[model samples]
Target: MLREAPAGLPRQAELAATPFFPQERYQCGPAALAMTLGAAGIDVAPEALVPQVYVPEREGSLPPEMLAAGRRNGAFSMTVPPRLDALLAEVAAGNPVLVLQNLSLPWVPLWHYSVVIGYDLDRTELVLRSGTTARTTMALSTFEHTWARSQSWGMVTLAPGRLPRTAQEAPTVAAAVAFEQANGAAAARRVYAAALERWPQDLALLLGLGNSAYAAGNVAAAVDAFRRAVAAHPDSAPALNDLAFALNAMGRRREARAAAQKALSLGGPWQEAVRDTLRSIDAAPRRR
Candidate 1:
């Protein structure tokens, strides 16, 4: 049996050791990368692709069984700083790594995972296989620092001990999109919270939280979160649309209309959603 790795949240030092890539966004973290790699027959389990620590208010060690399970299943939860260099070396050796961050106004902090696919030796760059990109090839070391300090940077590494033969079973991109679209506010809130815990500056997650809050009837919270997201990434279409919805929910019709217009100007698949929201707000009956 494989000796299990440690269980629980990763330390900062452990995070620094993972390798990086230049083509990927620092926001996705590691788990997303792992899923892609797993689908491609690379090392490690999809869940193990990133370090997701469910560290509650209490500080306690992880169970031995859980640790064993992680190791057996090719997953690892680690720390940062001291482990940084070593982790990078492993990743440089063809192993993949994932990182997560947490920060910003939150109903809860959420986790975002991405995979490190390759690196540049001459440029000290990290390559990443990311969900946000159709192209690969990215810098390594630069992403390391960005990921480390951006909200919260949690890291994990996968060894290339095995290869795949046949097809792999993994979540499809379309399926993931559908899941997010169909997921209820409560579920979206949980996912957003988990991701935000790792990346507070993540505009997408923040906007999603705001939308989810609005959907769940927490108008105030939705507005607050959306405002923060817009502050971080002003050009974000999702943030614009979600903010418009939040404003409308709060009875700020003028501001909501302006926000919807801004979203329309941004122009994305979200344009229709923004337009629909604007029309609904305009048609809503005034409460006595």
Candidate 2:
């Protein structure tokens, strides 16, 4: 995650054009969220996002609600590993990163969210779109101290097919699953395919591709993807069971039985699914 600052960017850079939507007190979450979505090319305002993120009992927005709000606006949100290098890379790559900082002491927490838009390597400074201020500057060291108090927690939300600089397979796949559960198979297919392109051997992503394909009635595509997933991880019973199901759908009874048997031998969390697949194959009319 330690990427050198690209020569393409200047010593100091800022997204001065980023719009500032004024926020009421205790609404920094919505305000920072509005700034993030706006920078991502979504024009939602702070007020419109209030009900989506605010929690009356907690007196602040919750992370799960914030993630859901991002998805509702047609993007996927996932946390990045807490590191200065990771943060700078996102800024250099033209993505505004939403960061959690303790404006006060760690023990006496003043949790605040701000967007990191730019940085100056020579001067060791960062520029943020903080609450009530369009452009706020803080020394990199000072910013690190505040950010560290929150364990450098940060997040990025992007439209489908747009990978973040610090993207990882586990979290990205988890985000994809949430998107699939909320939106549907079609949107999730894009996420699975995109992630597959990046991490070809990722077992979860491969399973996601196969599942989405199966749900969409593209059984041939499902078969091909499940085969690839099995090839990628032969020990994955879920992959073998899914391949068996796809084969059964394609009328390849022998291959289907073999796959199901292999899955059953592996003995995983999907044992019942494998057993069910075998029963279904037994019930189906034998191929001539």
Candidate 3:
């Protein structure tokens, strides 16, 4: 079951060939990072990324820092689910996954980062861009043993406006939030839009888009997003409270009043905010 490629995907898979960069000792983090980010769209050099990702105390690029660097380079460096099938499926779908592994024994743990660029099922080999070599080949079993020690950790970084092929709801939301923080709501708008396509009725995603739109002062867009969110989960207090605020901002006090009332009736954790929304709606001037 371990070597099985995802069904319906091609038996043999290789991503478009990209240039390779060699790493200095303890610089595998930067090398692997450059390979992945370069493919994603940014053309940054590994040396330029070293300051951001490398920590002297850590002796290697930390995974958390690597993710932060991905964000800084305009990608949401997401870790796919830690399973052989999941990793293979991502590669088969054309994503070059940056993986974490222990090159040394687990007890000793020589944490290394490498990019899995392709695989040949017939040969049962996985191709990697590691250290001084591009197209470094290892038996599937060997690769799995090393990778499994690192909890099968792999990044599925996506450039702006692109969504992950193996996305999960919670992680996508976290990435969306981080993307918004790093790139601002305008860039986040694109992320949220792409995410919504996959999870059209996800309340959190809708709220994210709504929040991003509202933060950008795009009240109309915010109203539309929050409305859709409330439609998906009608009694969501947070959604109703936010929708109430957007309507109030648009000077549609009557509608805001109703939404706020429903949220308050739900008596959820947002009740305080719901009461506040109702107060503002009630205080606003009525339309002529």
Candidate 4:
């Protein structure tokens, strides 16, 4: 496998410094999440996350619970594409991936969660912080077999300003929105800003960045972001409408009216919103 790895992927990579928390009983979810969050610079313990992710009734945690816990702790957490190559790419980029595996047969299931901290392509083995073991190495084929039973589910938790190496725009934006809902606009603003650097021409990311800034009370920055979105996608009605709204908030009534009019002229589903913005601009007295 090392001999046939994709270009730019290292033959072997290991994030040995990734933290570990041995699970107690059916607490692999919390333990694995703790390790991933810790590696992303969050000082959290498995016990602290037990309440957030652990389901005592089921004796295990759910995937949504695990992701929400990550977001609550200020990380841009998201599920990665279900592919071994995608997981390896994240690990090679120094992001530990939390993976779910059915360690038993399909009908007889033993669901488990572990953090993949390293891989040796030459040896065709993966290193993980598994149950009661800080460093457990499994053959790639065995790991894949177990992982396949779980539908290859995997997720990555990243600190603000960081992104998965193989991140897609839509998932990244969804993660930012989820982070905003869990944390706050300020933290999500940073997430959106960082994503914009990776995908400048992305309309959703630009709008997200601008909307987050506005929610955080930085109208000027919001206007700048929305202006950039409109510049990149001139035909985007939502961008022009948002830009108009932000400009009006900044007391730039004339420019706001112009943008709103343009948005109304290119109206689609956003026609009503543009009309409202123009009405507000007209209702407000001109600045002296």
TM-score of each: 0.39, 0.86, 0.92, 0.94
The candidate 3 region of ten consecutive residues with least summed lDDT is: 1-10
State the C-alpha lDDT per candidate: 0.50, 0.84, 0.86, 0.90
Clashing pairs counted in every model: 55, 0, 0, 0
Order of candidates by lDDT, top first? 4, 3, 2, 1
How do the residues 1-288 of candidate 3 rate in per-residue lDDT, one tens digit apiece?
384567776667777565588988899989888988888777889999999999888788878888888988888777888987777888887788999988789789888899898888889888888888877888999888889888889997777778768879889888888888888886688789898998899888899899889988899999999999999999899999999999999998888888988898998578888888898888888778
What does each candidate score in C-alpha RMSD?
A: 18.4, 3.0, 2.0, 1.7
Name the best candidate (by lDDT): 4
| Residue-level error in angstroms, candidate 4, position 156 | 0.5
Query: RMSD of candidate 4 to the true fold?
Result: 1.7
lDDT of 3 at 13: 79
What lDDT score is found at residue 102 in candidate 3?
Answer: 87
Model 1 scores a TM of 0.39
lDDT of each residue in 1-288, candidate 1, tens digit only:
102223321221122333233223332433354443343344544335334422334221122222232233333222222244444554544445544433222445333445554544545555655556533554444454445444334233222222111101221112112334544554456545545655578776676677677778789999999999988988887887888877877788888888888888988788788889889878977756
After superposition, the stretches of candidate 3 with alpha carbons farther than 4 Å from their true spots are: 1-3, 282-288
- The residue-by-residue lDDT of candidate 4 on 54-168, one tens digit each, is 9889999999888999998888899998888888999999999999999999999999999999998889999999989999899998999999988899999999889898889
Query: Per-residue CA lDDT of candidate 2, range 1-288, in tens?
Result: 224555455667676656677668888889888887887777888889999999878777877788888888767777887988878877777778888899899678898888888888887889998888888889988898889988888988776777687787888889888878877776778788988888999998898888899899899999999999999999999999999999999999899999999999998688998999999999999768
Off by over 4 Å in 2: 1-19, 285-288
